[model samples]
Target chain A: MQATLIYGAGDVRVENVPDPVLREPTDAIVRVLRACVCGSDLWPYKSRAATEEGERIGHEFLGVVEDAGSQVSGLRRGDVVVAPFVWSDNTCDFCREGLQTSCRHGGLWGANGVDGGQGEAVRVPQADGTLVKLPVEEDSELLPSLLTLSDVYPTGNHCAVTAGVGPGTTVTVIGDGAVGLMAVLSARRLGAERIILMGRHQGRTDLGRDFGATDVVAERGDEGVEHVRQLTGGDGTHAVLECVGTRQAIETAFAVARDGGTVSRVGAPQYDEVPMGFGEFFRNLTLTGGVAPARAYIEELLPAILDGTLEPGRVFDRTVSLEQVPDGYRAMNDRAALKVLIRP
Target chain B: MQATLIYGAGDVRVENVPDPVLREPTDAIVRVLRACVCGSDLWPYKSRAATEEGERIGHEFLGVVEDAGSQVSGLRRGDVVVAPFVWSDNTCDFCREGLQTSCRHGGLWGANGVDGGQGEAVRVPQADGTLVKLPVEEDSELLPSLLTLSDVYPTGNHCAVTAGVGPGTTVTVIGDGAVGLMAVLSARRLGAERIILMGRHQGRTDLGRDFGATDVVAERGDEGVEHVRQLTGGDGTHAVLECVGTRQAIETAFAVARDGGTVSRVGAPQYDEVPMGFGEFFRNLTLTGGVAPARAYIEELLPAILDGTLEPGRVFDRTVSLEQVPDGYRAMNDRAALKVLIRP
Candidate 1:
């Protein structure tokens, strides 16, 4: 089977790899139907997240179960499913609390020895918990929507829900990437009356508007916060979605939220020290949101996707064959594509 | 009138200062019946906070309403009241949301020309919001409790309540000052099953034990977290109360909370940065509480105090006249007192 691997920074390649087999009683082997590149993938591709000789890449996908281990319940051969990026037992205290991303018995998918989805086939551990069975069979048309259920859309939902974005809320979305765009949709679905999307590119901003952003602020730094505040009657937005993992984005989200509002940071922060000031503490602002447990949101969002009530897959600006994932990475890294779906 | 002024680090004196008079339509002049030195006061006394020459100190007090401005309503002369350290209109959006400390029309006491309660006669702005009427007249027996209502006790209550401490929750309390001891009581009042008090001295620990601390961990840093975890089935406490402002205290609080648990930090974080690691973020821990809106909790706890159901005032280990405030600051600064009450 063919899979994608990153030899080093900016060196993504598709090469032959072993077909996945169930190694544990809780595992299920899936024949990949569709997978996609995530914004987070750019981190390892751009940063020095040291890649060994040949490491499996990708964390988002929809697939058809080819085999199931003895202990795997609720999943079987020929079942179509949406796999959460992180695998959890779903019975741990953290998972039961809807914080499966922090599950004591769970770990990140595709990292370590666990196989990832950007391949021809993969073995999913804790199959009963990791796989959300699709009501419909694997079809070409529903691939994009099913693929999104793996990460971006659910992540966006987590950002909106965790930030307490609701009816009449004026939200400021920092970052115009796929997740940020999805957050706009999520906030809209959650009934945010006004959303200001902060981004510089025209294409992404237009998509943001389509996704329910009422306005766009193209500036950066203090100017961006001022723009958001001006649009929010100088009091700033009721909720802020900090989707970009950077000091500037976090600070901008903090500055653009009104006193007592929340900053939901879904971005995977890397730096040792966040540059947020203690002024946020005195202002009674709440900070939360990290590592979205996509599985927690899949059941709730499945109906909307199946019935055409939500079109989150509209974020896929480009699509390619699994062999061309390297090209997809370059296109996305260069801002040529919002999201790239790969057909296996 | 006499006021306590800090001329520099370790230099405090009780001297003659200008008598406070109502300066605004919403102001009220209070003849302070009781005031107290706070743990935060020792920050500047210990040369931790930036200080200027001859600045009046203290922000907590109970007093008799000596005079009221034209617009002051619901309050009359001779009425005994406990004033929240944060003066808010109590009608703004933030206030309505129970974050009066960040009220749009609110201002903090004891900073930049704001006359504080360390003086015999102190002027309180936004009197309608800051002053909580005491059912009883100003009596010596109620002095300690009423004085605590202004800051520490209510702050601790806010921390415990905000952290969702309840019958099954295991609460770990950081800091053993007046507020920390008060938090031990607050957690007990909220029905926390296990109250782990982390502190040093025998005096404060004994008080903590009396206040319902089920266990005491005298160690600091990682060892303290290990101690708490060991007591909590090796998963850390379900709730943590951080009442000390330093970075170390905040870090300890974070380290001692279980995954999916909350850390309610009423501590006035003075440091520029709180170093959080990947472990903290991935654990799904929630952090709430800061510059506690004591006004929000005062009404709920006031009756308990007046009826003698809650004895948070037991935290006051010493009392002195307003003229001896210098000695009070010195005693608290030298750790000779768990808390010091000043009678004006």
Candidate 2:
């Protein structure tokens, strides 16, 4: 089977790899139907994150189960499924408490301890807890939304909810990436009265608008915050969803949120010493964000995707063969595509 | 009238000052019956926070209404009252949402726009909103606890709730000042099963235990966190209330709280950065704290104090005349008194 591997900075390759086989009683072997490049992938690709010489790359996927170990009870062969980026034992105390990403024995896929989903076939650990079986037998058209549910959609949802975005909330979504676009949709679905998408691209910004962004701010930094504040009656947005992990994005989110509002950062923060000041404390702001516990959101989000209430998968602007995975990364990195999906 | 003023760092004097009078339609003059030196007062006295020469200080008090503006309803002249250190209009959306400290028109007593309570008579703005009336006309016996209700007690309660402290929670309280001691009591009142109070002084630590601190870690910095972890089955505490606003205190709170636990800081941070790592994200820890909106907790806390369910004001050790307030600040700053009460 073919899989993507990172050998060093800017070094990505699709090479032949052994077919996945179940090693644990709870493992399930899945033949991926669809997978896509993630913003997080840019961390190692851009050399912002430490990396080994060779590391397996992707984590988001929608696939069909080819085999399941004897202990797997909730899923079986031929089952179409969406696997959250992080695998967890759903029965753990933390998982039951809606913090599946912090499950006692949970592990992140695609980085050490688990196999990457960019491969033709992957082994999923804790299958019963990690995999969400599709209610219908088969629907090829649902792959895009399903793929999004694997990571981005749930991540966006987490950002919105953590920021307390709800009816009558004026939301500001920083970062016009696929996740940020999805956050626009999530915030809208959660009933935000206004959704502001911050971005620089016309194509992606348009898609974000279609997904539910009510406005767009093309500026960056202080100017961007001022733009949002102006849009929100000079009081700043009621909730800010920070999808970009950079310090600048976090600062923008903090600056644009209302005095007592919350800044939910779904962006994987890489910078230390997030610049915050007296203004933040004096106004009482809450900064909550981390890896989205996608598994916790699947149950609610899946129905919406199936019912056509959400169209997050539309973020995929280009599709490529498994052999052309490297090209997809270049196109996304070069700002030519929002998301590039690969069919293995 | 007499008031304590900060002539400069480490220099405080009690001197005769002009008597306070209602200055606005919403203002009320109160004759302080019981006022106390706060942990935050030591900040300026110890030169941690620079003070302007001859600036009036202190904000916690239980007093009798000397006079009321015509617009001040619900409170009458000669009524016994506990004034929240923060003066809010009670009409702002933030105030209505129970975050009165962040009220749109609210101001902190003794800071910037507000007058100080460490005087014979203090003028309270937004009187109807800032003052809570005692059910009985004469309740001098409840003065100590009522005085605490103005700041420390409610502030401690805020820490407990913000940290999500509840039944079966293992809590750690940093700092053994009046507020920290009250936080220990508040944690017990909130049903935290285990509480570790980090303090070195035997007197303060002993008082902390009496106030329901199950364990006392007489260590500082990393050692304090390690001791708390050791006391909590090596997983750190379920919640941490940081009542000391310093880099070390904030870091200690962060280090002591367990994965998925919350660290609530009510120490009025002067200038510091809360250092964080990826571990905070992966472990699902939450950090939330700010100036405690004592007004928000007054209604709930007042009943508790009135019913004898809590006695946070037991922290006060020495009583002095308004003229001896300089000594009160000195004693508390030097750790000679847990709390010092002043009568005007």
Candidate 3:
């Protein structure tokens, strides 16, 4: 089998790896059909130090089950399914509360000796709890959208939902990445009346507009804040869906959030400290959103995607085979592609 | 008229001042019957540099309407009322959303030239919006509790309520001051199944127990984290009501907050930065709460106080005349008084 590995900064490779086997009573071996590079993966790609061997990378995938341990229930060989970014025992208290990302018995892909999603095969633990069966065919055009259920789409939904976006909500989405565009779509789906998409890239912002952004501001920092404020009648929006985790992004989110508004950060935070001082505090704002519990949302968001009401797959501008995984990483890092899809 | 003024660190004085007059069409003059020194007051009390003229102090009080401006409505002379720490036009969007602290036209007492609550008379801006008429007598025995409706009690309720306290919820209160004790009481009133109060003072802890703290942990920092962990089956509580503004308090709040739990902070944050790094983000925690919109909660919480179903005023452990306010500040700052009541 072939898999993606990170050797060092900007170093990505596809190499032969041993086939995955069920290691736990609840584990299952999955032959991945679809996977993609995540915005978070860029962090390690930019700063990870060199290593002699390599580290498994990628956390989003859709695949067909090849084998399942004896204890695995409700799934069998050839079952098409989507694996959430994190594996969780859905029966845990946190999982039951719809926060599978915080499940006590949960673990992430590509770490702790687990298989990375950007590979030919993955060893999925807690199979019954972590994988959601897809109703689509193996080669259905819907596969791309269904694959998004594995991470990206759910993450975007998490940002809007956590920020309390709903009917008549006015929202500002910072970032023109795939996740940010998906958030624009999610916010609109959740009935946001107005959305301001912040990004300097015309191409990506144009796609964001197609995803339901009513306004686009090609500004950064203070200028971006002013543009959002102007778009929102000088009061700012009711919620800010922050898809960029840098300090400047967070600052802009806080700055453009209306008094009593919420700022939900889905971007993996790059900084350690948050500026939630007396000013933000006095305004009575709420700070929420974290690692999206994709597993919990797959069931709720599936109907729309299956019915052709949502087309989140539009985020993928380029596609590559397992062998070209390294090229996909480079294209994404160079900002030449919004998101790259990988077929293993 | 006489009012409390802070001339410098550890320097409080009762001095003659011009009588308050209605300055706005919506303004009303309130003759304060009861006022209290708050924990926040002690902050400036300890560090405020000496000034020749002195600054107005105090923000909690219950009073009788002395006079009303020509355009003021729904309030008449002699109507007993409680003034929230901040004055707000209840009709503002933020106020309508139950976050009156962020009301567009709101202003804090003792700032922006508004009369302080510790004064013999207060010229309340936005009278109808800032003062909630009390059904009790001018000198009712429940005056202490009724007075609390102005700030302390509503603030505690804001902490618990913002943390989503409800039937069978588990909660941790990270302070034992009047507000923290009130939080314990508010959590109980909201039907929390269990409440853990962190405080070292025996007297205050005992009062907290009476206020509904099922368990008390006196330890701070690492030991405190372990103590709370042991209390909640090593998972911490569902919600943490942060009533102390110090860094240690915020850290403890996050440390003891269960994964997917909420930490609502009502304390006026003394620091500028919040430590919400990857660890907390991955836990899917929600950080909320701010300076309480007490006016919005007054009507909802007033009934309990009036019916003897709740007694938050027991937090007031000492009583002093207007002239002894300086002593009251010292006693509270010295840890000799849990809270002080002032009669002008």
- Candidate 3 residue B161 C-alpha distance from true site, Å: 1.0
| Model 1 regions lying over 4 Å from their true place | A48-52, B48-53
Q: Write the per-residue lDDT of candidate 2 for residues B1-344, one digit (tens) a residue.
A: 88888876678888888888788889999988888888888877877445465888888987889899989887888899888888898888888878898787878777775668898888999999889988755445777877898899988888898888899988999998888998999999989999989989889889899999988999998788787887777778878898887878877877887776788878878654566556676665666767778898888888887887777778889999888888888888778888998888
Residue A154 of model 1, lDDT score: 93
Candidate models: Cα lDDT each: 0.86, 0.84, 0.92
lDDT, candidate 2, A1-344, per-residue tens: 89998876678889988788889999999989899999888777777344565667899988899999999998879999889999999998778878888788889776765788887989999999999998665557878878898999999999898778889998999989999998999999989999999999989899999989999999998899889888888888888899988878877887897876788887887776554445676667767767789999999988888888777889999999899988988888888988989898
lDDT of 1 by residue, B1-344 (tens): 88888877888888888888778999999898888999888877878444565887788988899899999998999999888888889988878878888887777667767886787988888898789898886665866887788889988888898788999889999989889998999999989999999999988999999999999999999999888888888888889998887788888888888876787888878777665445666676666676788888888888888788878889888889988888888888888988998887
| Candidate 3 residue lDDT tens string, A110-131 | 8989988999999999999999
Name the best candidate (by TM-score).
Answer: 3
C-alpha root-mean-square deviation, each candidate: 2.1, 2.1, 1.1
1 versus 2: better lDDT goes to: 1
lDDT for A115 in candidate 2 is 84
Q: Name the best candidate (by DockQ).
A: 3
Q: Write the per-residue lDDT of candidate 3 for residues B1-344, one digit (tens) a residue.
A: 99998899999999999999888889999999999999999999999889898888999999999999988888999999999988999998888888888888998888868777887888999998889999878869999999899899999999999899999899999999999998999999999999999999999999999999999999999999999999999999999999999988999999999888899999999989898888888888888999998998999999988999889999999999999999899899999999999999
Model 3: docking quality category: high
